[model samples]
Target: MSLEQGIVFSVLGITLAMFVWNRLRFDVVAMLALLAVAVAGLVPTEELFAGFGHPAVITVAAVLVISQGLVNGGVVDNIARLLGRIGHRPTLQVLTLTSVVALCSGFINNVGALALLMPVAIWMSREAGRSPSLLLMPLAFGSLLGGTMTLIGTPPNIIIASYRESGTFGLFDFAPVGVAITLAGIAFITLAGWRLTPRREENSADSKLFSVGEYVTELRIPADSPHAGSTLHSLLTTSGDEPDVVVLALIRGEQRLAAPSTYKVLREGDVLLVEADTTSLQTFLDTTGLELAHQAIDDQEAESEGASNNDGLADESRGRNGFRETNGHNDAVGAGDDKAASDPIAKGELHLVEAVIAPESSLVGQTANRLQLRENHQINIVAVARLGHRLKRRLGDIRFNAGDILLVQGFEDSLGGALAELGCLPLAERGLRLGSPRNTALASGIFLASIAVIVTGLLSAPVALVAAAVAMVLVKLLSAAEAYKAIDWSVIVLLAAMIPVGQAMESTGGAGLIAAQMLVLGENLSVASVLVMILVGTTLLSNVVNNAAAAIVVAPIALSLAGELQIASDAVLMAVAVGASCAFMTPIGHQSNALVMEPGGYQFGDYWRLGLPLTVIVTVVAVPVIMLVWT
Candidate 1:
């Protein structure tokens, strides 16, 4: 090989190694590779950032925004609710959910489709008393498999389409090979993949939906409390009695009573250490005229005039339980504006999120009080669940430890940044939108119209999808801020940075050199064998790096190899497209796999149990489909 080809190959090797190691972000590795190629004078420095503006990158970003629009406009909600009504039989549920997820993924961005369905999968697993592993791995694999069906379904398809010179592969070009492969893969996963999943203990902590009564809290008795003189036994029998509410201990005059007397009378200065879910705690306080000690003074001050005359929410039979002006004891936060007017989260700015602390979390040893989380991060720790035990401490005083799951509330825009700073990973996402029927119709209409425009050749795919995204913002289906957040910047960076490096490989004849080597190795093999080898190699590369990067790197070589074989390049390129989209063997292979890992309670090795067979099936099915359709 010449000097330029040797340098390009060396950079490609390093890049692929880093991707597999996964110590650095793929975007970071891509940029380093781009810089190395540019510094070597293989690509011009001025054109290094051209990939950011590439049509494929734009289309990927637009597709993501549009997917978010569908989510925020309640399109996914309607679908999920419809599918949720299906019975909870594990095999049937897996088939239905995975089929739906895969079908949606074929039209929308696969990761976006996975995000929309993950909560439903978790709920299904929880309701069925099954490990999330049974559902999540299949669902993730389904989304990946499904993405092969359409050009806009995944980034690899978009990248490969952009690389085609004849513009022969339009939006639906991938449908022939992709559909057959998706069907076979989905069938395998639905019928057998779930059974191969590891079965583990069913822990409520693993559920993304935080159940009520999982948090421990300390509530203080006030001077005017009617329960001040009531015995603990009588309180339990009272009309406001909640079975889940248990007094773990009592604190009075600096003494903690771990086993307080059942007949013990409550006092104004006494603090009751309680173990109750969030909902029960709210009801307990409202009915008994008790208040949180830390917020007692604030509660009094915030209590409006005639609030005492009103007898608080305890006496009133309001439909909503947790909408108190102060303390907010048991109010459940909804993902959309469906909440009652009294609900604080009904305001568009507020959101409730569950986040788990990572092992190396910065907040590991700090208490909320010390961090002044409310003041500094504008986040409130509503409750905490640690090791299946509810912590019976004041919300502010509970010290954070690794693996503690915290339910925190803050302004919607700041949650992502704040969670990152706290070294926490968000659990299952909740409350995607207001769920208005009108918004759903409008969003779906806009999306379909954009696709129609592309199919009709009125606009390019990137422009059409971009217009659709802009239309979503214009119609308020997604706010400008939300649209920006919907686009994954890291993915954008990786695609943009790697595009130039891919071009450098092609310009330097590195791809041709590699293709020549492969051709010589496969000289004695049949075309079918060569196709299988190409599919397997591309699938392995995609499993390690960003699939879009995989496509960009392999597409040229696939085309070159096909030329050397004196056969039609379409089938080989189709192989590259299909192979690049099926990264099911590892969690790091695709974002959808990574998205389901924590919630699924999955280990690194768990994926291949189902994924390996699924990959083999795709290869066995896709090669013939591509050869038949393209040749």
Candidate 2:
């Protein structure tokens, strides 16, 4: 082999290893490979960054923005509401849910499609008295199947289409093979595949998906309370049959003491920030005679107002407990008419919501205090659950991770928007806007028009989709900030960096070498066997690395193999596309899988119970379909 080929192969090998290691971000690894190829003189410096402006990258970003607009315009919310009416039969529910998700996957970003619909799936499972495990995996897999049906449905398809020399593949070029495989795969899961999923029992009360054992709230000592002068340790000792609650902090007038000493004396009107389950919280309140801080504030306000009306005292007088009162409000506990107007808890508008952190959430590495969640969003992180394990760290100190289940407390009116801005997916049914008919009609019209323009050959996929995204912003379907935030920059970077590296593999004959070796392995086999080999290889690669990277690396090899065997390259490239989108075996294989892991109470081994058989079904169905459609 030439030295350039050797260097390219070495770099490619390391890149694959890094991707599998998964310690570094995939984009960082792709960038490292790009620099290695450029340093080896395999690619010119001028072309090193050209992949950034590639049509495939642009299309992926545009699709993500448009997907966000569709979500903002209430298209998916309306569909979810309709889905709630599907009957309680598990098979029928799985069939209908998977079918709808797959259909949506064809038009929008598959991960986005899965995220939006996941809560619906969870709600369905709950309503039917079944574990979410039965529906979540199938929903995620259905998204993968749906992405195969259209050229713009998946990043891998876009990358594969760009490999063609006769301009990129048309919008519907993939439909014949993709639709057949999708139909077959969805049918299998709906009939028998869902049964293979493990039914993990969630530890819940009142049919809630997440455990409410660690909810944190504040309790205030009344002036006449029996335990007002007790020590902190003594108070805990006497409050319950056992110490089922923990005092996290002591809130004195203007000072907050975290983990206060056991001997610290509790005084009248002192607030104790404690964590306990619902049952235990009630028991503690019943035993200690302490009132909820907010309730005490209200009671005090009524008494102070009564005194002012009867004696004509000033409204700003101090209460007996040394709390400054103004207009029947307490300054000590930070409650007033102004605060009550905005603070949901003060107005009895509080709701405890359970949500899973999205993979692309801005909250992934932030703590509650660092994000100022209570200050900015008026939400409190009451408890957190991770991978079926309850977290014991203090709320403000626990760093958020993707897939972490958070029990957040906030006002019902504005909580949905806050969670959306924080990139969280609520597990419970939320009040999603059904959208004014005009907004929905406008957004849907723009999306369909872009597709129509692409079908009629008026514009390329990237240009048409980008124009649609811009139009969505113009119509206020999505704000400028929302449009920018919708694009997953990590994916964009990975695609742009890996594109040149893929070209380097082909330019240096590395892909040809690999193709030659594969042909030798299948020396006496028919062309169909070679096609299966390519598909299977790409599927395995995608299960380890990003699907787009898998397609970029394997497309050239499939084309080279087709050339050697004297067959149409279209069939082989189609195999690569189908294979790259079938990453159902592991959570690391796809973002859709990871997104459902914690919420579904899935273990790493739980995926292949359904994923392995589904993969076999996809391969058995995809090969012949591709051959018949393209050959």
Candidate 3:
């Protein structure tokens, strides 16, 4: 190999190794690889940032925005709600939810589609008294399958299209193949997926997916607060906001009343136990100066890790300094430390909440700058995920999407309503049903119109989708907020950053060296065997590395392998695409999978039992299908 190629290859190789070891973040690794390429003299330093401006990158970012718009528009939430009312049979519930997921993913973002439906799946598992393991894997897997049947269904397809920018761009050219694979995959899941899952048998009853040692705490509405003059009913009506924060008891000096009336007048020192999101609860605490007799916020993070036996009070020291009464000393909050700056809800009563931001909120692509999510609402967007790809940057600049899972820390008395007003719905198991059942006819009508415009070549796919988005917005079918909330920004960043790296590798002859190695190893093996091997490699790597990164890393090698075998590069590329998106084995592998983890009360080991077999089924089924049809 030439000097430049060897250097690039070594850097890429080590980066892949780090990714596999699961230590450093993939985006950080990609950025480092980009820098190494520039230093190795393969890529021009001036041209190094060029990849960040790629079409795939912009499309991914824009798509996240569009997905957010769709979500804020309320079309997806409407459909998800319909799926929720599908009754208590575990088999029927999984089948129904998966079916809905497939339909939603086909026209829009698959990851976004799954994000809307996962909470419903959790609810079904809890209500049916079945393991969430029975449904979430399938729901997640179904979303991946659903993306196959349409042009705009998934970002990878968009990236693939950008690669073939000058192709005829027929909508159905790939649809038939996708439809066949998706149907076969879903059928396999419906018939055998649930049985493969191991149940998480928790001692707590299944009906309550989330219930802690929460006491009925009270707050005093100060004269200087926002609710000073508001009616008792208006201030206490958190039912529309948070159902878990029940208004169980209200106390005024000597008299303690159960379920205080909405008309009751509010004065100082009124105690209430109202179920609320951390945001809402925080708003309440700061706005009303509420105090808790017992604070469980310190110990809840461990609960997220599934350690329920540790009493909420036993280990205040293991938590942050804010709750370290056991140590009898509070450390100073240093201005210079990064940790201090990063803690959004550092002061006041701390509440950690994981809320699912819908794909349709106007929040997508927005830095907390436009939203001021913390300053105005008193909540922080700590971490966000676009399906399996997680954000590695600041919570402020990371951008929001519909299906993005946000790890937010705030005071419950302060920020709940603002989150809801922003069109973000809590995924923490709520009483909210899908706002309304999906108008299948309207959904079908608008979606088909969008497709027709694209297929007939009347308009570009983006333009057509936008038209449908407008109609959905105007008709009150989908709100402007839902539309913006649906886009996945992390995937956009991963795709944007890594696409150039692939080009650099190819340009540097790194692709040739990798291809030579792959082909020589496969030497006399049949093309089919080689294809399966590539698919297998991608599948194994995806479970460990971020899948988008996994795809970008292998695309060059797969195309190289194809060249060596004298076969269609597209065929091998398709294998890489399929393999990278097929994660099911671990919660860490996919967001839909992880979203269900705590709610499902699943043991981490349970995934392999179901996921391993499902994966094998996908491989066994995908190879023959890809070879027969695509070839």
Instruction: State TM-scores per candidate.
Output: 0.74, 0.83, 0.67
Model 3 misplacement above 4 A: 20-25, 164-170, 202-206, 209-214, 217-425, 431-448, 459-486
Q: Return the TM-score for candidate 2, rounded to 2 decimals.
A: 0.83
* Position 430, candidate 2: lDDT: 53
The lDDT of each candidate is: 0.76, 0.82, 0.61
lDDT of 1 by residue, 406-493 (tens): 8776656777678856767665544333469899899999999999999999998888999999999999998898888778778899
**TM-score between model 1 and native:** 0.74
After superposition on all CA atoms, what RMSD does each candidate show versus the true structure? 10.9, 9.0, 12.8
Error of 3 at 277 (Å): 19
Instruction: Give one digit per residue, the lDDT tens place, for model 3 in 1-631.
Output: 8887778778878877876675555567777777777666777767778766765565555455455445554667776767657787667776888788987887666766776777677667756766666787788778877776766666656665554423523555556657776777777777777777667654443433222223223344554555655666566443333122334334454454433445667765454434343554565565445454233343464468755423322222333312221111112121122453233223343444556654335575576646756446655554565533444444445666545666554554554555655656555333333233344446556767777988889987666766776676666655666545443544655676677777788887788888898877898988788878988898788787777777777888777777778877767777776777777777666555655554454656777787787777777777777788666
Ranking by lDDT: 2, 1, 3
RMSD in angstroms between candidate 2 and the native structure over all alpha carbons: 9.0
The true-versus-predicted C-alpha distance at residue 300 of model 1, in Å, is: 25
Give stretches of model 2 more than 4 Å off: 202-205, 209-218, 221-348
TM-score of 3: 0.67
